[model samples]
Target: MDQLPTVQPHSPIMAVLTEIEYESGMEPSFGSIHDFCLELQELFTSSGWFFYVFSLKGVTKDGITGLYRDGSRWTKSKMPFPDIVYNRIHSRRSESSQIFIDFVEKMNEASIPVFNRRFLNKWEVHQWLNSRKNLQRFLPESCVYSRNSLQRMAASHEVLFLKPVNGSRGRDIMRIQSQDSTCDVSLSSRNGIESLNTCQKEDLPAILKRYLKKQLYLLQQGLPLLKMDNRSVDFRILCNRSSKYDWRVTSTVARLSAQGHFAANLAAGGDTIHPLRVLRHFFGEAQSTSKLDMIRELALEAANCTADSSEELFGELGIDVGVDDNGHPWIIEVNSKPSKNDHIGKSSCRPSAKAILEYAQILLSETNPPEKGGSR
Candidate 1:
């Protein structure tokens, strides 16, 4: 790997980028990203470290077209090679673009440390967890969706969740619940739940064939998740590696799904509640605190497990956990590029953003350590 130019340990630069459209002239902004930058700036002094936001097109052989604040206003300026590049590119199409791909390729070639490096698919994580005997208990029985796999799972589990292998935000997930004589399929959407009722059991294959034809899906046994007011609720724990490079739980919130939906993703019309409040509501005060602790521990374990398998540097993870009716916690999903939907205006989540910056500093030092002749 090529090496990024070494810099003074105390005064390294950090560059953050997301998709930018220069033609629109619209200010590049996202609520959570803005708050994150503000907090990162306040925590890391400008005299010590400089932070800049840029676009995909901004990157070139010379440097990045970075945006920095000049007094009370923002200004675009050419920047030097940063000690690290924090990629926040969100658009799939943008990431697939030749320019964006080249930028990442060059960044890697230059050995500029980038953490939270790439997206991990659902099937990949499930496979990793299943391979570990210690962690298998927390995972739902899952397998790549096939006609045989689907039929076998449907026989054992009354309810099965069919999820797109590479999907996020609870999109393109289907719930196949077997009723007495019919199978009810609920497809999750941004607008609302779309339900399909099949009258005959034999018709399930034909019905599912239509939906499962092109896309790859994972068949997971649905847990009897602990519910609040007839709505399923699960916890989303934000875990990050601190400056010390140890995993820590930063923020956790309980997501309550809409009345009939099984998915509790915030993007799927779910509401967020303080984890404790939701825990206490279901498990009561005595057990609620303990349950929260269990969730945190499992989250840390999941983070470490993934880090162990992946070669890429990861500084943060979003772990979704579901507590069964029996009070056992099940790992639902692990996200590499967790959404910032809940971070907006939530002071509690600021630590996660801070941890990312601190971890970046650690990576910078590891990649380009200062000489002993220089100041410690």
Candidate 2:
């Protein structure tokens, strides 16, 4: 076998595309960004990699107006665009702006690889993955929300989820359960589940029509997830793109919702813990291992399919999966801009930060390959 190409220790500067927000006295700060950004800086300190955060309007003909590291302090200044950009702009609305769109077009014109350029539309993603035969098994039955679609989906599944195509952090999702003649609708948000009161089955059309308005929604089949402590349990698998059609599972952890809660996302007050702790509770040691292995395999395959289905590039993803009581795995969702878990205890930099740094290096090496048999 041939040896791998060597990249220089002085890696190219990387830019994280984000939304700029100001704090007290106009001190710019993005909530919870420091956890991941600082980790990026600290991880490859000796390896000569520089990372900076900027927003949609920061790009220009000369350079970017972004926050930079000046020793231990962050200072706002003009800096040159880096070799690669990773999108972290939280809002899909901001990402849809003309400024962001133009930047991506220009980057493509320059042959710059900007992975995760836009957030995935849940309906579009479901169609992409569902259209593929091999991937369909892992996907729950879903359809673009409509009076007809919702009614159709409701007819099959006793419980259904009404998810906004652009929803995030487990916010603005509607859980509707059939109750003989009435529909019990509840909404899921970061705080917890809020009752929306029961409504007549026929009235759901008008109710959802006014509430959802023009925004797109996906009505999906709800899963019968494994529950522990009266709360539903699911797994989050962080995967990073290693090569074309190649993805590596970076971290796997189980998220358990509090009692009476429907969402298992950390943003929704869910708790993150080792997958084994919960898996072992349901199955024997060997069976638990098998279950986890199956989940990871499904996650990687889902990542590959999702990436392959997209026209743009993707360097990382957070694939959420939930296993049923029968030990079957189902794809919950795929997130391009996955949230970082600051609650996981700052014992050390989670491999997630390192995985991102390594993927950035891979991008650097690919776009600007090093000279053979030499070091910089």
Per-model C-alpha lDDT, please? Answer: 0.77, 0.79
Q: Which pairs in model 1 have colliding backbones?
A: none
Give the poorly placed runs of model 2, Cα more than 4 Å off: 1-11, 24-28, 342-347, 369-376
What TM-score would each prediction reach against the true structure?
0.89, 0.89
Q: Write the per-residue lDDT of candidate 2 for residues 1-376, one digit (tens) a residue.
A: 1122223345566778876777767656766666677777676554576567788777876656777665776677775556778888888788878878888887777656787888888988888778779878889898888778887888888899999898888788889888788998888855677887688999988777656646888889998999998899999999987665589998888999866678787776778899988899998787999899999998998888888888878888889999898888999999998878723555567887787778877877777633321121
In candidate 1, position 27 carries an lDDT of 61
Candidate 2: Cα lDDT at 284: 73
TM-score, cand. 1: 0.89
**Number of the top lDDT candidate:** 2
lDDT of 1 at 217: 89
